[model samples]
Target: MTLIDEGTAYGRQRQSHDAEIAEVGAGTPGGEFMRRYWHPIALSAKVDATPQNVRILGEDLVLFRDRKGRPGLLYPRCAHRGTTLFYGRVEDEGIRCCYHGWLFDVKGNCLDQPCEPENGRHKDKVRQPWYPVEELYGLVWAYMGPPNKKPVLTRWDTLESVKPGQKIVATGSSQGAGGDDTVEIVPTNWLNDWENIMDPFHVPILHTTFSGVQFVPEMGVMPEVTWETASHGMRYIAYRKLEDGRELDRITQALFPHTRIVPDIRLIEGPAAGVGWVVPVDDTHFRLFHARKVPEDFKPIEVRHYEGRKWSELTDAEKQMRPGDWEAQVGQGPISLHSEDHLVSSDQGVASLRRLLREQIRTVAQGGDPLGVTFDPARAVVKVQAGNYYRKK
Candidate 1:
């Protein structure tokens, strides 16, 4: 067990992952916990007359808007012959299966069966699978849990208090961070990115020092950090003293389920203007949906640059030279094996996030409601406490 033989890569073994907190399928603990809250499935602008295939929580679904202007999400298979509805046509009533010309409404109610007698004498007996969907904050939210357990779609105070001429702009690309260009679907487990929200120490190291000032010079200063558990999830505050004699308190939050409310990287004052959701496409892939308040005709500023080139403009070699979150998270492979992680004092936030998630998973396993979910409309709006504040020392 000397240095020559101990802890060597020659015979090192890979450890198993924490599947209970990572797997997001129909019946898994993590999936069931996620189902307790509504998640953004698509940008409202993306769901149009053309049927688009989407996968969420490990289920394949088709999303489209009917001629009546109602958005619908349904199982892709035709109820009769199992043909994918992706080839189906959108109609005034709903969508029509190309196979037998059977028509179903947005709610998956069979409306007509052209080949059957009397428009299908038993058409009423067949129903296509569908999920409950609603449009809010420029995104389509869906509830995939038990119908009786569906809670009111929670709203955010930050997004609701839009001033005149300001609107909530929703982006579903590039990890949904409001970036104009970047990878859409992240090829990794959702938890990898979700956990990163709590680990603020990486900002100064990875984005600043390692990536050569990706955000701003102020972000490069290492800060003293503290973590706290909120009713919804958990939050952290990073304290830094600026050269100009102002104490900076940057607060970031990871809300229950999968929402991250982070202050602007430039240390903008006031509460966080947007929220991002790490949505699981399946066990190995995920996507991000973000909604933020901005002025009319607002354009995204390219702040993260490496060697005088924007992230989207960088070549593969440049990306490696100036790695950012995408490189760090995706580099962890499809799923970061939790068993291999060696926790440190600085990883308190990451540790707390995992603990919170585990508690919710256990709550669902015991047939109880998870955190941050409510049936009361009066309590549906979540008040965000994340922001950047400055005080004179």
Candidate 2:
């Protein structure tokens, strides 16, 4: 018997796992866990006299470079009157609050307090909130964790393996401007984006099965994968059988916290790209920062843009017909409900990654250093093992 009318009610019940994993504020478990490592905040070329608004780890910050060429990341609100430093002036010494001419250096040391005369005895007592920032490989990275726990910012081998005539190119959307073929702020949790790197099965299905062919032809064939734990993170070694009676071995890596080393989408004729970071803008947003070394004379590589139109410009039917990772990932509804997902054999990597992240979180909770953190500069250079290999028939 069919009922005359029926309706379904949606509940907002959330799980403890989701709350622990998704929330990334200062006091939150995920935030404290992630802050133990350095994360990309802005591209080096983009930081200048103008103060840009940045949000990371659920905190609002202002990023700028002083006249003397020192980059800074500080709490946007002025310490004196809670005025946003976004309108502050960038001086040779540091940034000066426009409200009352209070000056602060990159390290948040109070340099001068104009309103408080007599050498401003109270100036030394007041310090604005700030984070430690450093630049490497054309990106500005910040460590938002405890000062004493700051780790040496690592320089991965891929970024330094460039040939004599080749240089690294910084291409990504930052502060509302950059190369046209770069990704902007993704409207989903950072984990959702990071998890995709582990799920190799989706490549043959999402990029090839539903859509005609968005990636390399070799990727159209499904792969048999094996996951292994690296010193810093995890790696997925995938093998694909090709029509030429040769096998393809693609090794992809996900460095602890956020960085992911992905292969060329359309197959690389030259050297593979350097590691790129999946920086968390906040709990609900994230951005991508990628650097690839290319010949000095090389121009920007053009990627397929859905008939030359951006993803946002595509129609609903168009997106449905040519669904990409953006659709598949963001479709997980911001922070995917981890408790609701059913783990299977194919989800081994995802499960492993989650366990590793939880272990790191637990380590931090136990007052121990997480993986890959070091204070010694000499030991900061990491060699990443990720590339594509083709076997001879």
Candidate 3:
């Protein structure tokens, strides 16, 4: 018998994903768990008179603002003739479909049917499907869960207290930071980016060592790290010794569901001022929405350069050499196959995150509320503890 080389891929079987934690379509285990809380669907400025088409959780919906200045999220199809409401005209009362003149309010109520007698005597009986929308922190949030299970839209304490010169700013950009040249929607599984927030080990290796100090010189220092389970989600503290005999203690949190609370990577010496949401457009595509407090004319996302070239200016070969988060996460494929991952002791944070997500999925499946979601108005505001601190040895 001929002996074959060990561990060759010639006859290896295909890998499988952890579907319970990856799939995010309606009725899926992960989808149901994600629906338990509100998600930022669009920037407030983008939803105006003209309807904007959006896809979230594998469902296509239209978002618009009625002439009354109320934001609405509705099923794009007209209930009467099945025509898309994308071409509908915005009127003071509601949106009027161009096909049959059917009108719908922000709550999906049928206001009128102009093509029928007495504006359609049975108009009150017809309704269009819609999700509840609320504007907060310069972003439009939607609750796509069961009506009875809807909770208050969460407010972050870090984004609330704006000083005299500072105001709440929001972005729906690539990685929640990149400029116009970057793709607004990330082409990868949501879990790929979501789990990354917990894996602090990557910063020293990927951002500093491999990427050649893409962030800051201090980040190049290997940190002493510890992880813990926080009330909302998981938290990690990384301590790095500086050349001046001072230690930098950075605290970051991965809030329940898909929120990331990270201190300003510029090593800003204060509490974190922003939060980012990794929202799933589907099982394979995701987008980021971030809100932070900054002074007027301040651009929150700093343009990054590698090898003396901006990210957008790099060639394919250059990208391969100096890949950032976009390349790293998306390279894991649309949905990473969990069975193929060789996790180790350094991956404790990633493992813990997956376990927590599975627990939440099971919780929702058992008809119980998931963690970090509260219906009480008093508990709607969540305090952020992620920040940068300094200590002298």
Candidate 4:
């Protein structure tokens, strides 16, 4: 064969992969799968008298709290003449369309039509599309799936099972100090962030080794890991041999439909006390929603920002010098091409998570509940095991 430069070859094409896991629009596998559960749409404090534009699963919608403080998430367009509800008025009973005074309540029920005849059958038949929204943990969560199949919002055991003197700290935004109410919106696919939770190998390499001691000194050493399926999702156990005659065992939980109960960001050597979520904004963007509990005697751990600067405040050179998870995940492009990935043995957890997500999607397509989802509130208290423990050799 003649020597050839592949770089000069014609028709070099990039293969597509995992559209079922990446795409979150209506009717797509991932979209259909995600709609089956409750997702945090916006922070509860963010919604007010003025309607705020919110998008999830590729659907354009508006979230607003009326004069009476009742929260409503409705399709942005008014049922009458398709006017955008963003320009509507929030009334005592519901939101009224500015176009013709069509009023809709939290349940999407059309309550009034000022411009229509008193007996106009159109007013009775007209209803704006809306989703069920609940205010929990300082976040506004919405169920965008079938009305009959909607499952109860979970109060995870990690938050509910707190012992005496332990209380929950609800962080409204994904991007603030430990107790701040602001959050930063990350620019990447939801899957990119979710998959990272299961990837333990990267901890020693990315955060510790190459990144130059971003975490505790003990985490710099490489770890041997094993993964297994959990009732609500999956868990991975990592063993790191310490310099002394002891082994550090870290267990992280990857909950189904985008939740992670991992170690506290503070690097504490105990059970994970935080609930983190990767909430999809669309196919190409997502945001993080987190809540955790702090012991009475312990100080709360702050969310990680790079070198005391917000991600937007970081210089390109600074990011290159100390790249974090955001840089690593977003660098893969909006939606990563799994076909192009050369996954190895160390990628076992990631591979397993992808398979489990695909299986859950398939289950939902077959008209069944995905793993860890329950309609009963009593049974919704999920038990998760994820913490760091030390054992003497």
Better of 2 and 3 by lDDT: 3
Ten residues in a row with the worst lDDT in model 2?
173-182
Residue-by-residue lDDT tens digits, candidate 4, 1-393? 998776864786767868988889989988989999999877777789899898787898999999999999999978878989999999899898898888899889988887767734576677788999998777889999989989999877777777899776665454521112343566678888888888988888887765566667777778889999988779899888888767878899888899977785445677888888888888887878877787777774443445776555667897787777777887888888888898899998899999999999999999889987799888978775898877654
List the pairs of residues colliding in candidate 4: 174-183, 175-183
Per-residue alpha-carbon lDDT of model 3 for 1-393, expressed as tens digits? Answer: 999789987879999999999999999999999999999999999899998899999999988999999999999999997988899998887788989899999999999988899999999999999999999999999999999999988998988788888888898887442223366888889999989988888888878876678778888788888889998889889999988788989999998899998898888888899999999999999999989989877865546666566677877787777777877888899999999999998888899999998999999999999999899999988999899988764
TM-score between model 2 and native: 0.92
Give lDDT for model 3. Answer: 0.88
| Candidate 3 regions with alpha-carbon error over 4 angstroms | 1-3, 176-181
User: How many clashes (backbone N, Cα, C below 3 Å) per candidate?
Assistant: 0, 0, 0, 2
- Lowest lDDT 10-mer window, candidate 3? 174-183
TM-score of each: 0.96, 0.92, 0.96, 0.91
Candidate 2 per-residue lDDT, tens place, 81-193, comes to: 99999999999989999999899999899999877767578898989999989988888989999989999998887788888899998755521111134457877788887
Clashes of 2: 0
What is the descending lDDT order? 1, 3, 2, 4
Alpha carbon lDDT of each predicted model = 0.89, 0.81, 0.88, 0.81
